[model samples]
Target: MQAAQTQRKFRGKNKAPKWKKPDDGHVSVMVLPLAITDPADLARIKRLFGSMWSIKRAVQRDARAKVDAYWTAFHEREEHGAKVVRQRLGLNREALERCAYKHLDASGHLKHHVSKALAMHMAAEVWNGVQWHLFADATGKRHGRPKTGRWHDFTRIPGRARSHTTDRKWETFRLVGTLHGHKMAYTDGGQYTVQQPRRMRVPAAPSGPVLTGKTLASGKTGTRKATWWDHTGPLAVVFAGGPDSGRGDLVLPVRIPQQPGQWARVEHFLSNPGRWHKVDLVRRRKASAPGGWVYEAHLMILGPGYTAPAVRERREQAAALDRIGGVDGNVSNVSVASFPASLDPADGAPASTEITLSPEERALLEREAKKRRGRARALERSRRATNTAQYGPSKKQARRAEQRAAKGLKPKAVTVPGGARAARVDGVPKQAFRRDQLSVNYREQRARQAEHAASMAEHHRFRARQVAREIIAAHGPVLVVEDCDIRTWYRLWGKRLSQTTPGLLIAALDRECQAAGGRLVRASTWSTALSQHCLCGERVKKTLRDREHKCIECGLAGKRDLVSATLAAFVRFTDVDDPKAAYLDTTSSRHAQIVFAQGLEEALRESTAPSQTTVRGAGHAAVPRQRRETSAPRTAGRRPRATLDEPRPVRDHAGKPGQRPGCDPQLTLW
Candidate 1:
C-alpha cells in the first residue's frame, strides 16, 4: 500500500507528468539531423555502426546455440525432472551472459562497459525466447521447445550513463541526455573548424565562449536542410573539435555543414536541452541526397501531463436515454432503429436505416482476394520447384518421368512425390536443405505477402467497425439480434461465401453497441423460424430454395426476409395474437407502407381467377346468403372448389401442378 501511494505521487493524478502543456496520450517523434561534411568522418561513422551490428549478431548466434542445446536436453529429460535438467545444464540468463563475455573478451573490440551492455542484451534475447516457448506450449500451438532464429537488424546502444555525472547541476533539470563539451559553429563560406585529437591530456577549458543561432535574437525554428547523427555511444563520446574543459556547462556543440538558416531547428533543441532524453547519433548513406553520408540525432522529447474533467451522469436523466437507439444485425447487413428525442414509449415509432457493402467496395474486395490467392499459389509453386531440384523425385514421380521419357516428352518437376520417403544424404534428410538454402528473393516475397495480408485484413475489419459505429449513431441503446451458427454455415457453404456472412460484422456491431452506452441481446437461432411462420402463430413451411413466404392460414405473404424481420420485431416488442396491432407497434410508417403494398399485390393476385378452373356446381345457381352463413361461414380469401357441372382441372406454371400463377417458379432466392 505504501509503494502504491508512492507510485501515485510520482505519476500525478492521471498518469506520469509531461514536459509540454496540454499533453495528450500520444508520443510525438522528432528527428534532428547533424551537419557532418568531412568524408573521413562519414566513413568512420558508418564503420562504427556496422561493427556494432556485427558484434550484436555474433551474440545472437551464440545465444541461439545455447537455446538449442537446452531444448535438446529438455526433450530427452522426463517431465518431472525438466526443471532439474534445466538447472544442471545452466540454461539461464547468467550462463548466456557469461558466454557473450567470452566471445567479446576474445575479440577485444569494445570497452568494458560496452561489453557488459552487450552481454545483458544477449541474455535478454535468450530470456524472451524461453518465455515465448513456454507460452506456446501452454497454448498447445507448439509441441515442445520452440526454435528461434537470428532476425535482429538494429543494435541498441544504452543512453544516460549512471556512474558518471553524479551530483551534477545539469542533472537537476530534466535534461534530455546531453553531453557537456565544446561548442562548434559553422565558419562562413560552407566550412567548419577542423581539430585533430591528440594523445596528451587537454586543458581545463576552452578560451572562448559558445556562439550559435540560439544566441541570435532573430532565427527561425524550422529549417530547410538535411542532417544526421554524427556521434553515438554506449559510453561517453568526446568530440575532436570541442572544448577540452572542466566545469563547462554547454551541451551538444554542433557544427553546421551548410548555410545558417537551415539548422535553426537543431539550435532550438539545444536551447532547452533538459526536455530531451535517450539521444542517439544515427548515420546513413543516401545516394539521392547531395551528401554521400548523412547523420541524424534521434531523441525523445518530454511533455506535460493532462487530466480529464470529471463527469457525473444520472441514470434517470431524460436526455441521455432519449439519444440511444436499437440495432438489428443480420447475415449480410445491419439495420438501425432510432427513436426521436421527444418520442413517448407508449405511442412512439422508430426510424430505421440499413448499412451494406457498396458494389464498388465488394468489387475491390474481389480484386484484392484474387491478387492474394495468385501470390500464394506462385509462392507454393516456387517452393515446390526448388525442393524437387534439390531433393530429387519420389518413386511415383520417377515412374512418371520414365514414362514421359519413353514417350519422348519432358517430365514435370514434382516435390515429395507420392509413395516415396524423403531421400537421406549421409544420414541427414535431403529436405533439411529447406532450412538453410532459402533464397533471399523467397524470404523477401514471403515478408511482402505477410504484410499485404495483414494490411487487407485490417482494412476490412476497420470498415466493418466504422459501419457498426454509424449503426449505433442511427439507433438508440438496446440491440436485438438472432444468434447464428457461423461456423456451421461456413462448413455448409464454401469459405468464400462465409466471408460475405456477418460473423465479423456482428462482432463489430457488439463492440459499437457497448461503446455507445448500450447493450446487445442475442435471441436463440430458433427465432429464425419467423421466416416460416406468421405473427398470428400460423405455420407456413418454406424450402431452402424458397424466396417468398405465402401463409395460407393468415394471408401474411411477402418477401421472406422482410416477413422474418417484421415477425422478429413483433415477437420481441409486441403481441403475437393480433398481427395487425403487432405490426403497428413494431413497424415505422414507411415500412408499413411497403408491407401493405406487398399484401395488396398478393390479395389482388389471389382474387384473380386462373385461365382454367374446375367448379363442381357451375351449372347450379350461386348459394344463398343464409345457407352460406350457416355452413362454415365460407373461409375468407379461399378459391372456389370444383362443382358438379364444371369438372375441369386448374393448372399453374404453364400447366404444371403446385405452381402459382403470375409468379416465376425458378426465381433465385439468396
Candidate 2:
C-alpha cells in the first residue's frame, strides 16, 4: 500500500498543472470575521496566538544565528567570496530547512508548544526570510538582514489544509458548517410531490438556520411536515491536542456580512465548485474593539472565473485591437503613444494620452499625508517625553548649546545623554541607549499613523488601477517602456515620486496587459535613448528644464514626453528577453513623422491657446524660452541670423565663444 501511494504521488506530480491562461481560472479571498464574545474563548485564542508567536520568534532567532555562523565560517576559510560560500555551504532551500530544523530541535521546550507540523511551518517561514537575505547578499543587493519578530508583528497563522484523507491533515484547525436547502418538488396529478434527497435552492444569506430533510406526510391539516433547522457553528482552531485536551480549542463563531451585495458574492463563491484551500487566522488591531483586536479567517478559493465585468470587457476589447504602444513614465506623469498593428501611419495619428492625478485627488492625498505627518510628530513627541533618558540631544538643541557657549550665558541641559560606547563600522551612533518606555498615548498615535498610511496606500493603489485600466482600454494591451531604474528616480525626486507613484501605475499596467494576453516590453534605456533622440534619427541632448523637444536637424518639435513616447512606439529589439539589443525601426520613421507633426501642432496650439475652463495639475502651458546672443551677421553656409525683434539666446556662463548657451558643453552634436 505504501509503495502504491508513493507511485500515485509521483503520477500526481507528473500530471499537467491547471490554469495555464488568466481567463482559465481565478483566485479570490473571502474574509470572514470570527466572533468570539466569550471572555474564556477569547483568552484561549490569545494564548494559542501567543504560543504561535513564541514558536516563530524561536525559529527566527535560530535562523539568524545559523546565518551568522555560516558567515563566520565563510570568512574563516582560505577563499571567501559569494561563489566560494555557495560551494562550501551548499546554500539552498533544502539546506536551510535542515539547518533550521536542527536549530529548532536544540531549543529546549520550544517545540512542545505547537505540533510538529506547525513547528515545521514556522521553520519554513524562517527559511524563506533567510533565503531572501542570503540571495540578496550574494547578488550584492541592498536588503536588511532578517530579524526576530515581536509580539505585535505576529498577525497571522496559516492552517495546513481544509481536509485531507492522509494523516498530514491539520485536524486541529477545521471549519464546521453546512448550508441546507429545500427539497425539490414536482406537480403530479395537479398535486405537489416532494423529490426525496434533492435540494432545490440554498439559502442566499450566510447567517440564519437552514432547514433540510423535508418529507411528504399525510397529516390532519397539512400535506407536508416541518423539520428543525440546523445552525452553522463556529470554526474550531485547535492547538497541540484536541478540544478535550487540557488546552481547549479556540472556537469562534463566523460572522458573515449581512449586506445584500456582499451576501450574494459570498454565496456565489461558496456555491462554486472550486477547490477548497486552507484557512488563515489573521488578527488586526481595532481601538474600538473589546480587546483592541479583531480576529478574522481568510478563506482561499481557486476556481474558474473572471475578474470584474468591466475589467474583463476592457481586456477583451484590448485583445482585439492588437496595437503596440510605448509608455514614458516621469516623476509627475506618464505619457503613452501607440500605433496600430498595421504600420500605415497614414491611417491616423498614433493614439497619445497623458496620465496624472487630478487636482482633487492630489489635494485629498496631500491632506491625508499631512494628517499622517502630524500623527507621526505627535508620536515622536510622546516617545521622547515618556522616555527622556533613551534619547540624546537633537541637532537643534546642540546648535542652541553652541550659540549659548559662544555668548557669555551658560548652556541649558536639553536631553539626558546616553552611555557612550565603542564606535561601529556601520556608522551607527556609538552610544548605549535604554529601551523606550512606550506610553498608551504613544501606541495610540502610532496605530493611528499606521492606519492612515494604509489608507493612503489603498487610495494610491485604486488610482493606479484606474489609470492602468484607462490606458489598456485606449491603447491596447501590448506596451513598451524604458528599462529605467525606479530606485534612481526615488532617490532624485523622492517626495514627488511618492505622490505620483509612477512605479505602482506601471506595475498595474503590466498586470493588466498580461491578463489581456499581451505583455509589457522593456526597451533598453542606454541603447534606445528615447528622451535624448528624436524620430528623425538625430541625437538631441536637453537639460532637465528643457520640456520641449526641438530638433534642429529635422525641425521636429513637440512636448518632450510626448515626443519620447512617440519615438518609443517605433522601438524594436533584436531579442525581446534581452533589452540591451534594442534599436529603432527608422524605415517606418517617415510614416510616424506625420503623426508626430500633427501631435506637435495640437500640443503647441493647446499651449498657446487661452483656456476658458480652469486647468489642473500639469497643463500644457507655454514654457519660457531663454534669450541668447545672436548679434553675428548671417554667413553663406550658416543658418539665418536672428533679427533684432527675435529673442537672443543667453551666452554660456563659462564664456565659451560660438557655443550654445543652454546646451551642455560635455555633449557633442551627433
Q: Say which candidate scores most in TM-score.
A: 2
Number of clashing residue pairs, candidate 2 = 7
Q: Against the true structure, what is each candidate's TM-score?
A: 0.42, 0.68
lDDT of 2 at 658: 51
- Residue 218 Cα positional deviation in candidate 1, in Å, after optimal superposition: 34
**TM-score of candidate 1 on Cα atoms, chains taken together:** 0.42
lDDT tens digits by residue: candidate 1, 9-92: 333474544333334544333455544444444444555455546555665566556557766775556664766766665666
Off by over 4 Å in 1: 1-367, 390-433, 439-441, 477-494, 501-503, 510-670
Please report, in order, the local distance difference test score of every candidate based on alpha carbons.
0.44, 0.60
